[model samples]
Target: MAKVTFKGNPITLLGNEVKVGDQAPNFTVLANDLSPVTLENSEGTTRIISVVPSLDTGVCDQQTRRFNEEAAHLEGVTILTISVDLPFAQKRWCGAAGIDKVQTLSDHRDLSFGEAYGVVIKELRLLARAVFVIDKNNKITYVEYVSEATNHPNYDAAIEAAKKA
Candidate 1:
């Protein structure tokens, strides 16, 4: 179980999560079009798995926007923003935010994506905020599961790691 704080309240998560050097877990996430898009389909490309509790929250929205701005410079990589939000909501938010560079994927239908990555908060029905960088070979090279939900992650460091990945 992973332990993190939500507004100063301790929250314990349940699962054995993926770590750096582990074979990244595969998942089928919903796209904006409500189509099933599998991680395997995006193989051979560097990936950034931006796992968040919810996109509706202030921190998550900021994170997505930050990554979207940085994504343009990383020409051959795919930035995937994931949350438990419905695909329709993800689509609407992306369109409203002008979030084009990052691909917003949903975990509403099933949380296999959350469990596989070990970021699911079983108690809250949310995911632990995390940023994972997977290389072209599907090897997870960098991982950061935030210890506090209310806090934002180190975007600069994550970007540097993703660049290396």
Candidate 2:
């Protein structure tokens, strides 16, 4: 498991850590409409999965917005922002932020994505900050388990990987 810290305090993460070159794990997360959005739904498109603890937080909000802005130029890529926030809150945040390009999905119900990606923070029940870039064939090409939960991820490298895919 990757070492992670929240607010300078070490937190234990649950599940197996994923690495580049591995097959991307499939997880069912709820879209803003409360409908299930699975990895299979994104088949045939390069995907940038931005995992955050919550959308209401500053870092998570910025990360999602950044991806939304970049999505316009990424012709064949799909950007997804997964968080443990409820569907209602996620939908409201997207509406207020005018975030259309990045699909904001909620993992509160099942924690499927969090557990599968080894990002679930046992103490807080929130996901640690991470970034994953999966190719159209569903192979992970880039993986970043951010050392600090509150910090932003390497946007450039993740974006470049998606572009290449």
Candidate 3:
């Protein structure tokens, strides 16, 4: 288990993290259209999994919005914002926030996304703030798991890594 904190309080998380050059774990998630989306199922696209705790929080919201804006200028890379939020809620949040570039996928059904991605907060129903850049073959290239809950990641570096993929 990975020891992390929620608002400075202790919380444990599953430890199935994918490392550099490791193939990303396969899982099913629900898209806004209620269709199942799987990272391993896609072909010919580099995927950026922007795993966030929840869209309701400030940092998570900012990350999603930033990725959405940055994705517009990139090519051949699909930015997916993965969260435990329900598909409807995610869609509403994105629409209200004017986020149209990144696709939000929910882990509400099976919670497998957290397990698969190793970001799920085991104590509370939350996910950790993480960024993973997967190449066209689904190999994890860059990964950042924020130790603190309040901090935002290096936006410029992540975008550059995604661009290089």
Candidate 4:
């Protein structure tokens, strides 16, 4: 597992650590309307999955908005921001932020995405900061597990990986 810290305090992460070249794990996360969405549903397109602890925080908000802005310029790429926040909150944040390019999904119900991606913060019941890029064939091309929960990811590297995919 990747070592993580939040505000200078160490935290435990539960789940297998995912790395580049591994097959992306399939998991069910809820859409804004509480409908189930899984990795199997987006098989043909290159995907960038942005995992954050919550959307209401400063870092998480900026991370999602950054991807949302970049999504507008990237053709044939699907960007998803996953968080433990409720579906209602995710929807509201997206609307208030004017984030139309990226789809914000909630992992509150089951933490399937959190476990599958190895991002769940054991102490807080939240997802640690991370980013993943999966190719059209479902193989992971890039993985970024931010060392600190309150930090940002390598947006350029993740975006470049998706472009190459």
Q: Output the number of the lDDT-best candidate.
A: 2
lDDT, residue 18, candidate 2 = 93
Give the distance in Å from residue 65's predicted Cα in candidate 1 to where it truly belongs. 0.3
lDDT of 4 by residue, 41-112 (tens): 788999999999999999999999999999988999999999999999999999999999999989999999
Candidate models: Cα lDDT each:
0.87, 0.95, 0.84, 0.93
Q: Rank the candidates by lDDT, best first.
A: 2, 4, 1, 3
Q: Which residue segments of model 1 deviate by more than 4 Å?
A: none
Displacement of the residue 162 alpha carbon in candidate 2, Å: 0.4
TM-score of each: 0.95, 0.98, 0.93, 0.98
* Candidate 2, position 130, lDDT: 97
Ten-residue region with minimum lDDT total, candidate 4 = 34-43
TM-score of 1: 0.95
lDDT of 3 by residue, 12-109 (tens): 78748778889888889999888998876555888888989889889999999999888888898899899989899998998899988899999888
lDDT per residue for candidate 2 within 49-143, as digits (tens), equals: 99999999999999999999999999999999999999999999999999999999999998999999999999999999999999999999999
Better of 3 and 4 by TM-score: 4
- Colliding pairs, model 2: none
What's the CA RMSD for each of the models? Answer: 1.1, 0.6, 1.4, 0.6
What is the lDDT, from 0 to 100, of the residue 159 in candidate 1? 82
